[model samples]
Each structure stands twice: as C-alpha cells, then as structure tokens.
Target: MPDSQTLGNRTRGMGEIVDIAGKTTEIAPFGNTLAELGRERPEIVGLTADMGRYSDILPFRDAHPDRFFNVGMAEQNLVLIAAGLSKVGKIAYCTTYSVFVTRRAYDFIAIACAHSMANVKIFAGMPGLLNGYGATHQATEDLNMMRGIADLTIIDPCDATELKQVVRAVADIPGTVYVRNLRGKVPVELPADYKFELGKAKVLREGNGEIGMISTGYMSARGLDAARIVQSEGHDVGLLHVGTIKPFDKKGVIEFARRHKRLIIAENHKTTGGLASLVIEALYEAGVYMPVVKIGLADSFFECGSQEYLEKKYEVDLPRFVRAIREGV
Candidate 1:
C-alpha cells in the first residue's frame, strides 16, 4: 500500500501541469444576467459590501441605480439589509467575497436568511483559490461552512455560461441561496442551449468505464481539460459537472458513478466537507464500492500568487488531475 502522506507530498509538488496558457477573458455574465433579470423582475434588489465592481454586479447597479445599495465594507450589515428587503417581499441579491460571506456574516446568513427563510441570494466572489489573494481572501472552506446551514441552497457554477444560468435560476427560488460567483474574465464552457436547474447535475461526456471525473464550480473546466489528456493517452475517462454543490444531486452522482469502475471528485474547494465529501457520503449510503480519488486543496492555508501557480502548489491544477486520472490514484 502507498504511504498516504508520502503520496500526498509527491502529488502536491507535481509541478506545472500545462504552461500558463489562455488569455484572461473578461465577461460579466453574473452582472449581465442579473441586470436582465432585474428588468423583468421588479422585486429583485442588489446589495453589495462595497464590492460591486469586484463581484461583477456593476451592470446591475448601473442599470437599476435606484434598486442598488452599497453597504460599504460591512458584510454583516449587507446580509441584514438583504434580510430586511426580503421581509418586504423583495428578492435580495447580496454581493461580497466568499470569505467575507462565510466568515464575517455567517450569523446573518444562518439566522437572518436561513432561519427566517428569506428570499436572499448571496452572490460571493473569490471562491476557493480563484483569488490567490492569500488566506484572508481565498475561501477554500466556504462551501463547507455554508453547506451546513439548513434551508440554504448552495451553488458553485462551472463557468460563465453556467454562472448566467444559475443566476437566473436562483432568483426564482423562494428561500435563501448562496452562490459561488465567478468574476473577471469568466470562461464560457457550457453549450449555448444548456439549461440550469436547481439541484441537478449534468453529464458532459460519457467515456469508457475506466474512470469517471466529477467536478463542481470552475474546476469542471479544468477536469475537462485533464480528461482530454487522459483520453489522448488511451484511457477511458468521463466527465460530470455538478454545478449545484448543496442539495447535492445524489441520484445523478450514483447514476454517473455506476458507469465507471473508478471515480474522481475534482473541485476548487478543500477536500473535506465539500463536493468530495458529498460524493463519498452518497456512495457510502448507497453501498457502492468504487475506488474514489479527490483532487483539491489540502488542509492548509494558501499563499499569494497567480491563480494557476496557487492551483499547482495545492495540487488541484489541471496536471495533478490528469496524473490522478491516468495513474488511478
């Protein structure tokens, strides 16, 4: 048997998977989608903890100046205001960094929104390692924290396309929703006609029954890239995009995993209590015995660097996923 710690160290320093490739594409799908929805839904109100620009909600703010509220750097107050708006029968769409929402304003989210069942939508930016702004900003455990809240829907979209679809879908839901928002040059990976439904997972590709890759948030894009490399090397690897993290689609996961002998859960968040945990729990409950591999951040704080550099350091980059899928780790 492989020493788990030694294997972990080897995997963490696997070096650059692929060169820092691809130009940064800036598309404000979140803000754009909100703006479009706001025009159609009058009850939609936008709130920000002075992160309107960073969270990509500027388009919504600009379009509905009267309906936008900047709550400054006070994240707790932001949730409070959102809760109040929800009480008044308005759909509150709050914006802030993932750390701010999970750390600073967790109470308001749990009590003000979740407890009261407010129609508040918290759109959080800088999800997991996407920020690379050090420990203070990287929300590697946001999903873990937010998922424990009862009556709160957790969503981690895969790309700009899914981001737009999720934004529109969450607005229609009645209770509290926590969304892992992607900002600044978000990539468009999903098909144009793809529709987003709450608590449903989508299977992107059906590979040979050798390996199945399950991914959430933007990590699905990375998983796809890794799957391509695995396929090129003559391995049969499939891809499943679990966009909705909480209220996890267990039926979808079980069905997808049934088609493969080994399964890998790839996510941008930490290994524990996130997508990997959900998959493991589902598998255990169903008495499935497939070997599972997890590709995500280890139990540690992050450093400041470019997104790609941080990803490689944590062994959650494209190359690490490729290595795990190819080697059956």
Candidate 2:
C-alpha cells in the first residue's frame, strides 16, 4: 500500500446527499423503473431479447403488455424489431446484456437505429466487471465501441437516482441512447434529487488543496470511499460525479479542473475511451494544463475473477483507490 505523503495533495470530501424527491423509496431494478417510465410517457415501450425478468422489464410488460415486446434471444432481431417499432413513433427501451446488445447486434444497431437516428434506449446490463461471467459477458469497452456510432447518445449513469431520471428524459426523445444499468444492490449512492442536466458533472466533494477525482458509474461510489481514507491523513480530496459520457460536459469539467492542479480520474473500466479520454479531451480543448493521474483498469484484457477480486485487481476498490490517489500524482 502507498503512503499518504506519496498520494500527493488532496482535494474532494467524502460525498453529498442530493435530497431526492418523495420519501427515499427503495425501487425495484428494471420493473418499477420501467413501469414508472411507462406511467410518465405513454409512448415509452419496453423490449427485451428474452430478458424481461432478468433485466427488470417484467413490470412494464405486465402493466403495458400491449406496448412491450420480447423478440426472443436474438440480439440482431431485437435491434431491428425495436427499430421497426420506433418507425411507428414509439419510444422503445431495449433490454439485453451489454455484449449481446452492442456486439451481437452491431450492424443492425448501426443501420436500423443510428442510420435513421431512431429513439431506441438500450438498457444494457453487466457493464465492466459487474458480473464474473467472463469477457463474453463483461462490457469493459462498450463506451469506446458505441460512442463511435454516429449521432448516438451515450449515458453511463452512476446510480439509481440518475438512472430513473434518465429513463424519463430519454423517453420518446430523438436519437439512439446506450445506458449502462446496475442490477442488484445498487446502493443509493447519489442523493434522490441529484440533477440529471445533460452533459453536466456534479461536485460530490469539494477539494481545498488536494486532487479532484472525477468518476462515473459504480466506481464513483468507490472513489468516495478512497476520498474518505485520504482525508483521514489530512489531505483535501474532491470528487466529480459525471453521468454523461458522450457530448460530455466540457465547461463544467474545465471549471472543476481549474479549481485543482493535481487531478485523478477513476472509473470501473480501462483508462481508454471512457472517463479518462473524455477528461483529457476536455482539458485539451480548453487549453488548460494540469497533472492528471489515471486510476482505473489499464488498457489490457482483464481475466475472469469474482467481482471483489476483479475490483481489487483493477484497483477500483476502495483500498486500491486510496493507494492510486496516493501514487497517481
């Protein structure tokens, strides 16, 4: 483990509670979230490639059975079917594994969805090491793949708070969207009222003189833990919870980066085209110079392991995260 002195100057705090609307309700995974979306938008239809129950689209299927469609297990068929539905002006939220949805249905997704700029929201399950189902199931580089598709909207939500709100926001909205979803035990990390302004990053913890760590998805939660440990050693640590990956919030990130010179970017993925790439692009465009440390899985194929094991190996775990902050700069 690295020492605190080696961790460089700190910036962010532990985290913030966003005071979500309604009494803090523990919502079900895919079911209630979809059902709520259906209630909010009449044209919002649910589709899954034989994962209605597994992906949590059962409630929507049960409630609005007329609109919901299950195109069996073929991912290609799933995309074309959803695209066909979108032609009739329906907002279709397709559910499938990240690999099956992005890789298996690549051509169909490109031509049927992106070519026409259809409104198909892909609710992808098991991003990165969320599942130990091996590389066949893990979508560690889905962002790098999908963002390459033209006119496609990429939103990798950090928690259920933004997930629920984004579901409503993309309902019937134009263009194709790929959203990474957390299935079970998605701790209410972000506050309920956490805003979902498109292309915006939230300052979960404000740093005084320490490094600012910007993160997305489950790793942001882990980053919070890392921040706590570093602060105990009397370092100022800050966190930037970024929800939108594509069409990223450049100004907001530049503003956050301007506050601190030493920066750390943490994600549950390779330091490739995910958060790290986005931050570097933003800083380059802004012509702002700063020392940035990339704390994430490196650009290599990760072997199969338990979720905890993979997290530790990837250094996105709390203890490793603290060490990365200590060593990154």
lDDT of each: 0.84, 0.76
Candidate 2: worst-modelled 10 consecutive residues by lDDT: 10-19
List model 1 lDDT by residue over 40-97, tens digit each.
9999999999989888899999999999999899999999999999999999999988
Per-residue error (Å), model 2, residue 260: 0.7
Model 1, CA-based lDDT: 0.84
**How much is the lDDT of residue 31 in candidate 1?**
94
Residue runs of model 1 more than 4 Å from their true location after superposition? 1-26
Residue-wise C-alpha lDDT for candidate 2, range 1-329, written one tens digit per residue: 32222112221111111222222324445567788778878878899998776676788888899988888999999998889888998888999878678888888888899889998889987788775656677788888888788878788877777777777777745788888876543456676567886767888888785688888886786677678778868777888988878768888888899888688888767789888988998898889888988877777776666565566667766676776677765
TM-score of every model versus the real structure = 0.92, 0.88
What is the lDDT, from 0 to 100, of the residue 165 in candidate 2? Answer: 78
Per lDDT, the best of the predicted structures is 1
